[model samples]
Target chain A: MRGDVQMRTMESSYSTKEVTKVPGWHGLVAWDLLFNNLTTGLFLFAAVGELALPGLLAPVAKAAYPVALVFLLTDLMLLVLDLGDPLRFHHMLRVFKPSSPMSLGTWSLTAYSLPLTLIVAIEAAQALNLLPAGSIVLEWVRKLAVVVGFLPAFGSLAYKGVLFSTSSQPGWKDARWLGGFVANSALMLGCAEMLAMSVLSGHSKAAASLRTVLMLLLLLNIIPAGLLFAEFHNTLSRLYRERQVYLALVLPFVGGTLIPLILLLVGDSAPGILGAVSLILLGSLAIRSLIIKIPHASREK
Target chain B: MVIRELELAGLPQASDPPIGPLSALLRRLTWPFRRGRAPQPHPATGFYTDTTVCIGCKACEVACKQWNQLAADGLNWSGNSYDNTAELSATSWRHVKFIEQFAANGRPTYPDHADSGAPSREVTLDQLLSGGGADRWLMMSDVCKHCVAAPCQHACPTGAIIYNEFANVYIQRDICNGCSYCIAACPFGVITRSDFDGHSHKCTLCYDRQRDGLVPACAKACPTASIQFGPVDELRDRARKRIEELHARGVPEAYLYGDEPGETYSELHSFYLLIDRPAIYGLPEAPFNPWLHLIGDYMRTIVSGLATVAAILAVLFLQGS
Candidate 1:
């Protein structure tokens, strides 16, 4: 039942009556569902946000395509392991259930990911001028790509928090802040992309605009996290109680939220510039790290 | 201990067929466990583990494995302790915990002892490694307590898991969506998702056996009568008497695990009478339900719902403007 150690990043304990038996194989199915929803959901949301507001972004949003496609492939591979036939993944698509997180997540990924992939391919083709720009078809495709790419990225990012929140686990049940966490994480991620593109494009007006978005994002991300930490501390559950809270709350808050917020507020001076980018990047890393280590019931021995 | 099995007047007494209206009225008031009657907590269920009488036979383990038909897990030696099977798992439902500690100060080997033992004969490092005079070796077969207010059932998302008519937590495999919410919610880390089926599973308190009017496999196979099972009320009295006897015999640490109704989960149906602090056996010092987090969940859900609506409305208003 220790599904994986990933579930137990925080300390917790409880007493219950243990059931001795059931008729079947070991519980691989549950692990698959959890892992798939988590991994795919994260990618979908990240992709959506990146694609949604490209004109306002630095160096455009072309690179997010390749990043998202890679995640799409990773998710597909993970999905293949969940069934007897990987080809039958389309079966999940035959019907849709809005109330079902998995169904919603699966359909969202399928719907958003394919168009986004095509858009990225077209963008790449145009960037290299492989597609003749004067052609009406090419122009139309570019316009469509620009319009359609944000849905999956935002959807994927936001769905995971909802998915986790709806779960019966006491730890997850209180996670109303999780949706905001995902949104903030997406903004942080978006900022990182903007920063990279700005550096590549040099100090243009676009770069300055990118900096503005990044700065605004820094604020958007920090406040909710501080609130989350305050709320997590208030939890009466045994799992939430810790003598000195570590990775799950404090580390993510400090490394991911506070540091970046501080840097962005200081207005991108030399140290601030370097620190802002690094802290934002580090924050994303911490966000993902906290996600992996946040202790589910399965991890406890 | 009073057994006042109230015999109320009812219709259809064998001696007198076709009973009257007064008999029916009397019978209606007799059944205390019926609807509209306030439930006095069923005389607090508990376990009377006579560890001193335990032979460490491990029949309980075998019985559990056979009844549950759990796959053999971690067959290889773990080297952490004598427990190659390490701890409880989705595959291994019953675990036998072996604790090695000092038994000096003439402390009785019982779970009730709030204080850990005083230092026994201190051996040199070499002697200690050689297993020289290792004072106390505690063997406990740990299982779920069937807590009065079971946390796992409360935490399950798909409603796949539930407390049955027997008041034991049972997982309905078909309904489980494999969300693993119950896994994180369980404070004890007792309920786990089986890696194979993708559904959470745990000890059922031998629901099948209970229906057949038989004890759980562990209790039935306990050669030393260490893992006794039955009506919880009767068990508590037996545990109290045994603890008193142990104290008289100079074993002061003979306390009960999950037995107290107030400090812990109200009462443990499968509660244990132990001879040492719970921590020594990997039990929490004090365990409480995680349901209290629901208040936060409720407030946050409402606030977030309002916030989302406000954000959407603001966007719409701005677009109109």
Candidate 2:
């Protein structure tokens, strides 16, 4: 009986055709990446600027900080809305698993928000004269906020890249350079945001300084973005061949890198600077969306 | 009034019965308060799916759906051979794959090598039934691997995906925040988000049945004993013996997948005995663990961040001087 069963089932077969499956990540995830990078990027830029050149760029840093906080809050709301069970989001903070990027991100976001909120509140109080001017205690608190905020801001900025690189999707896994790419892009976006704020507020000196900073950041961003594109080209030629990939490259190169570089070279004018900043911001979002689209694009025929 | 009083006099009053010493002892031993210690972990159990014996009946699939109370994935032909349901999804936990290959005059038609001067050969119905050619059909029922170090568990922000006492990966639906991180993390592409509820869903490895000392519905319903359920170690040994038997009988391609911890992750509790390369069955040849490659990436990010800070400080100092 066993022999009969074995014989009946032992047929050999061969199939040379391979099957490719699409990734499950959707549009919400793409939006999450965009918001996360933007929020963290702006805060880090402002905090670093304030810490590094406290006296020279105080007004720009102060203006950028509150704006960054608003974006951060919006990003948090977006994250919650993205959850399938939004009510159970608290479970994310209930446990901390060092091995899990998602867990780390949740804790980092929560920790980062605390100092950020304090900085925003204190700055607002000082601006409104609720806190006495030139108080040593207020100065100390401000210094402490900057120190406490920097670590989490930096972690939050890079966590999205780590999250993407850790996924099993072939397009995402092969592009390990994405972490650095995202971090640099975040910095560029932050700089562009500050530039926009300075230009709009008619802070000419601040705007010029921001323009120079934005140019340097934009140039730095190209290194990682170019490396990521090259890696994608080598590993996922099919996706690299798609029109969307070219668009992704061009949007960042022309809008983010080239146009911004040209505008900075031509000297800072209010309108021209505004145009470049707006383009960089749009390019930042487009590039992130494209990164999310790569794996899905590869799944097509 | 006199008749009612007479009838009442004939009735006896009810009283509580005394508890026996044995009954009292039993009650004390089984008391909820006394059972406060953590439940002992169940032995690791798993399914050993021997794909060589599957007959494409889809009995396992039906049984799993019925037992789990899963909704039908609709009857839509996918035009991919006899695979109507296609790949595994949120609603369809068990998927039976049918791979039909044809040969003419004992030579296989190489469709993949169409441009390489390989002749296109077709086998008719009569030729296949008469067994004059090398035509054959391969059927395998696919399910979640229930990996020891499950990436879904690692990727879950809410710790919703966890290892049960039976050593199976389980997703706690109530705890899941629907971040879909696990969907990306899963190398096997097993887990999927439900359209209606938006939470990730995958095979739970029949934890409830295992706790009740019963075999999973799929294993119980398998007609040819292709899906065998037992202790993972025992299943591994059985799979090894079966592979050896197949080798001795001239079937050399038989091998076990996810039976041992490779470079990617850990051993899978539910593994497979496959005759073809893993990719043929839609499995990655070399799976990667995200956690494994994270440290180097983190270090690089830290170093680059520090370098940027230093550069900024130097620029500031130069400007000031």
TM-score of chain B of each: 0.70, 0.80
lDDT of each: 0.54, 0.75
lDDT digits (tens) for residues A1-301 of candidate 2: 1122223333222122212234455676677777777778777877777787777667777787788788788788878877776755676875788677778888888888998888888888988999886889987898798789888888887777888788777677777678878777777777788778878887776676777677777777777777888877744556465675567677678976798789777977887888887777777777777778776765553
Instruction: Give candidate 2 misplaced runs (Cα > 4 Å).
Output: A1-24, A240-247, B1-38, B104-133
Candidate number of the best lDDT: 2
- Where is model 2 chain A poorest over a 10-residue stretch in terms of lDDT? A11-20
**Taking the candidates in order, what DockQ does each have?**
0.04, 0.23
Top candidate, metric TM-score: 2
- What is the Å distance of residue A254 in model 2 from its true position? 1.7
Clashes of 1: 51
The Cα error of candidate 1 at residue B90, in Å, is: 2.1
For candidate 2, the share of real interface contacts preserved is 0.37
